[model samples]
Target: MSSNNAIVLKKYIDPTEGYPKIGEHFGLEERPFNLEATKVDEEHPLLLRNIYTSIDPYIRIRMQNPKYKSYLPSLGINQVIPNLTLAEVVKSAVPEHKTGSHVIFMSGWEEYTLVPKQAMGMVQSVNNPYNLPLMTFVGALGMPSQTAYIGLKHIGQPKAGETIYVSAASGAVGQVVGQLAKAMGLYVVGSAGSDEKIAHLKEIGYDAVFNYKKESVHEALPRVCPKGIDIYFENVGGETLDAVLLNANFHARIIFCGCISQYNNPNPYGLKNYSQILTKSIKVEGFIVMNLMPLYQEEYFREMPKLIAEGKLKYKYDVYMGLGSIPEGFLAVLQGNNFGKALSKIADE
Candidate 1:
């Protein structure tokens, strides 16, 4: 068996420094992926070829140094790029995991991996699993869904009759948040980068939608939420966030799920309207979904799927085929080319 195929990061992408570079591939003997296989190290489980992989904005943050606690830790210099993946278990020494089972975990941008078994979650428990697409486990029903779950609970704390605005409204987290807000009886408004995405938001039940690229957020937001936005589900930051700050009602809640606007920058931008957080009595907080994993396992997983099955919730994904296409797929996402959750299919029926 051969194991030379992998996507390795060549070095840190310091824009002040220069453009990002990709490294060359190495064989299994080189073990450039740093797979550790030792028994009694019960947590790590050897994962088979991934069925699906995710390309989210958060992964871009992990490419930076350990300074931002947004992710577990930055991938090591010269290491395989880490990503969220859905994989079948080829072997497992852990009691909870069985060979041939499908699970979700942190793995490499490759065909196979040895993820710590404890990091894996059994997806079969979600009910009627076969009827649902496997890619959903990594998208609407997976990490992005989890991000929405926590963002709403901790940041938005949405109440009935409140008006909420979601930026980047057609992307993975935005779609989930918009639908969930509508189901919660809130008037949901959204902003998207394209007209097509704005239309999709309306089809999914957003009360109002705007194409941010066509209309300035400063102008479009007030027109949509004239009563003022009580909750802001922020995905793209920078100017959009500034506009939201100006339009926020008193006592607003801002859930900072991501700042996609600043991800590619060599020197990240600072929010100029931050002082509004104090003036509007707004609560602004940022989070990475991993910190909320225990909460999801304890409460969200049990509640969210029922809402989904009942049609009160919805999700979307943009899927690509084959492991080899991942880099291009991910770049498209970084460029906002994907409308929803961006993912790739590495396995077939």
Candidate 2:
């Protein structure tokens, strides 16, 4: 039997509210590995070796009980923490299964997972005909891609020749929105926290990018986006969103993807420019990508990969090695310290 090393939540503590480091709430351990003498049967379980697990700020939202319940299930304390994971099949007991095939499911941050046939619905068979990096499935062509596509094509109802601005533009979701907007014939501008990220955003086709840490968003927007923003892909809310509201064009569209800057703050992230939203006749709408996936799942799967293959899109990742790094890696991404999507590799494929 293969050993299962897992990342277990020690307790359900909001890492953003009081605790600065989330590692204190998580621990790694070797879980039960023993198997039945002859467990194989007509309908059997599938054992998978976890390859890369995505670490994002949204993981912090799951660290709550009923009082702070989200649409997603809460993490169970003293048990394995599960998120979007890419894995390879190592052992299969079912006749229809093929050993060594790759699949993705909402699995744990563990070395191995034994998934029963009843749980097959949660798994998705990955198609790698283009043989792009497997990480692409979890980052670009996955949830982040869907979130960006839906925000622009549907919610924003964007048109060409307009200017769109993205906050936290270097993160997983923001980068895709910027690239897609550029491909859609819009003038795309974005802001990141550092000079290097600003450069990366420009490299990925952002017409202009500013280091928000160096210059205040309110002061920089007018210079970078002289034409006025027609669409605002909101990622960092508090101060940045306030600035966008004041600078946005009349009838501008705002896609409320997330408020990562306010996620860990103990105090409420207040706003001072919401009046601009009304005065400018702006439209602000919030959406959960999960709810929109079914409507455009086929389109996303086809378009995103095609964009990547034709060199129309680019994605980045910050890979961490081994189980021990999970705590810090997860923390790094949540705090906006990572340059790209955070992923932890448990084993080589």
Candidate 3:
């Protein structure tokens, strides 16, 4: 009927610079978001708020001013912090789009977003609602799982019986990677920041689990991987990565997924074992999900759902209800307080 309210970010965050950086909210505007009733653009579709939002770790990268040449620069000052959201189309100007169609996108931290056709790759349809949870399109069946699928298969290239280690192993990407590695018959071990997270990793079938905050990575990794690690699914990249580098088997592969440990750093921490890369002859590579689109289109759509249906793949979600809580929930994710896929359920229907 009328315009909907959206959560707007007033300023960029610098997690270590000060407290003001992390939790300051400034509303921008309460404007109309209608499309068909108004003069509709040929490209944009008017979307409804089916599911509000989800908070993800990668979003923290966009919250700061760029230091090095990042693939995508940090978020601009006073902009809506973007995330993957599941939305229903209420009206559309594009003939290809129809009302009542549910889709996923990196468009809104707000209730409803107007997605342009050019950006449709980021927004995919949910046609198998009878088989899968709709929110999973933004979670296990979505970007996170796709990210893990690409990183492990392409970069990590794990072989059965080889040791594979994952950091932040209880979060969205880590959990999926661990499960997939186990299914492939690899020896999987992982480290998390909490005791609870370690238990969760074990429950998910990790061979060994450790709380990196309490145990030394240097000591812990060596003990678990006596034969040295064949592959590492890196997430928390600081001391943990350094430790893996030191003990990695010759020609071991390392997939640089996300550096969650250093995302909030005001000052950077230099890795002490980088020289190990050269000495051990390790192949280390960084990747983004979009780069492996062709492979993912084949794997994610076909394999992930089949695994879920057969019970080979299991997923967990941390849901926060109501649209108004989007901002707070996002902040929690950036701070590493959320486990599993952080979700905001805006509507049950």
Model 3 residue runs over 4 Å out of place are 1-3, 14-43, 50-52, 66-68, 117-122
lDDT of 1 by residue, 212-305 (tens): 8888989998899989999999888888898889899899999988888777766767678878889999988888787877766658767776
lDDT of each: 0.74, 0.83, 0.76
Clashing pairs in 1: 43-117, 44-116
In terms of lDDT, the poorest run of 10 residues in model 2 is: 35-44
Give the CA lDDT, 0 to 100, for residue 5 in model 1: 61
lDDT of 2 by residue, 164-259 (tens): 999989988888999989989999999998898888998999998899989999899999999999999998788898889888999999999998
TM-score quality measure for candidate 1? 0.86
Q: Which candidate is the best by lDDT?
A: 2
- lDDT of residue 7 for candidate 3: 60
Candidate 3 lDDT tens digits, 123-157: 66676833676776777776788888888877787
Report the number of the highest-TM-score candidate: 2
Give the higher-TM-score candidate: 2 or 3.
2
How do the predictions measure up, each by TM-score?
A: 0.86, 0.94, 0.90
